[model samples]
Target: MSVEFSVFLIAVAFIGLVVSIIILLRKAMATLDEANKALAEAREAVRDLGSEAGSVLGHANDIAAQVKDKIRAIDAIVNSAQDVGQILHTVTDTARKAVAVLNHTPQAAQPEYVPTNKITIRKTSIDALAKETDRI
Candidate 1:
């Protein structure tokens, strides 16, 4: 009777240990499932951040290109201004030379003296005198 009772007690203990092990495994599986869900969420957030970073970089590149174009335009304007300044200086120099030449040119001199004379007339045949006067 003692031997039968000991065997029954060992069988009961073995069943309890198996049940405990199954419960612990179920809890562990639940924890692993929660961790997997959190990992998936983190990965999604990282992907979104990467996409936003790419957009920002693209905008920066566009701005850089626009700035480069503006700088080139400014350089061209400056060169044109320099050319205009040189042309203006040349025109000014030419105008100054023309004014100097005009200032130094000679003028025609007026005659210094003039004489006054009187003439005498004699009576003659009327028609002949009229003709001679008309000829003079």
Candidate 2:
């Protein structure tokens, strides 16, 4: 073969190799672009989640503060109720002691009995009522 012809063939082969490398580089660049897009989407999702979490935390904090205030109010109410109960107990005890002191002397005659209601018991119906209750 002539020298010029061989040189030209070598040059063509080198050009073909360079073209293949450029195509491969283009494909690599496309893949990198897709990865970058996915990364951007992930970052956006993370940012959205962070904001949502922050809002949720803020709401929880508000609710917690309200709950604490309610608990304090309830505690104050309970303490006042206890104080009232203690005062009532003291009054009741003093009334009982006063009554006991007034009744120090025993009376010879008993007081008359007062009946509010009259109850009648039937022997026949009692057994039947007990049997019915047992069946239930």
Candidate 3:
């Protein structure tokens, strides 16, 4: 081939290669833009999910604190009840001792009643009077 014709053909091939590269670069840029938009949407969704998780954790912490407070209050109530029970036991013991002293007998040696002849006669008369009153 002549030098000028060969040079022209090489120039044409170079231009075509440049055009093809430009078209490929443009398509790559469009694909990159789509990927960037998807990435941005994913980041926003993650942010929303993080915010929702934070709110849920805050509510759970509040409930845990309330449960702890309630448990402490119940513990205080149980301790107070035990103290009252101890005081009641002391009072009961004191009352029992006082009754034992008033009775003036050993705890195991309580006296039994023995009716005399006079007491028996009075009881029989009272019973007869109650029967007559019931009839009336």
Best by TM-score: 2
What C-alpha lDDT do the candidate models reach, one value each? Answer: 0.73, 0.76, 0.76
What are the per-residue Cα lDDT tens digits for candidate 3 across 29-75?
99999999999999999999999999999999999999999999999
Score every model by TM-score.
Answer: 0.58, 0.69, 0.65
Q: Which of candidates 2 and 3 is the stronger one according to lDDT?
A: 3
Model 1: worst 10 consecutive residues (lDDT sum): 119-128
Consecutive 10-residue window with the lowest summed lDDT within model 2:
105-114
Instruction: State in Å the error of residue 15, model 2.
Output: 2.0
Off by over 4 Å in 2: 2-9, 105-136
lDDT of 2 by residue, 84-126 (tens): 9997776656555544443452441453353758533345345
| Global lDDT of model 3 | 0.76
Model 3 steric clash pairs:
none
lDDT of candidate 1 over 21-62, digit per residue (tens): 999999999999999999999999999999999999999999
Name model 1 segments beyond 4 Å from true: 89-136
Give Cα distance to truth, residue 48, candidate 3, Å. 0.6
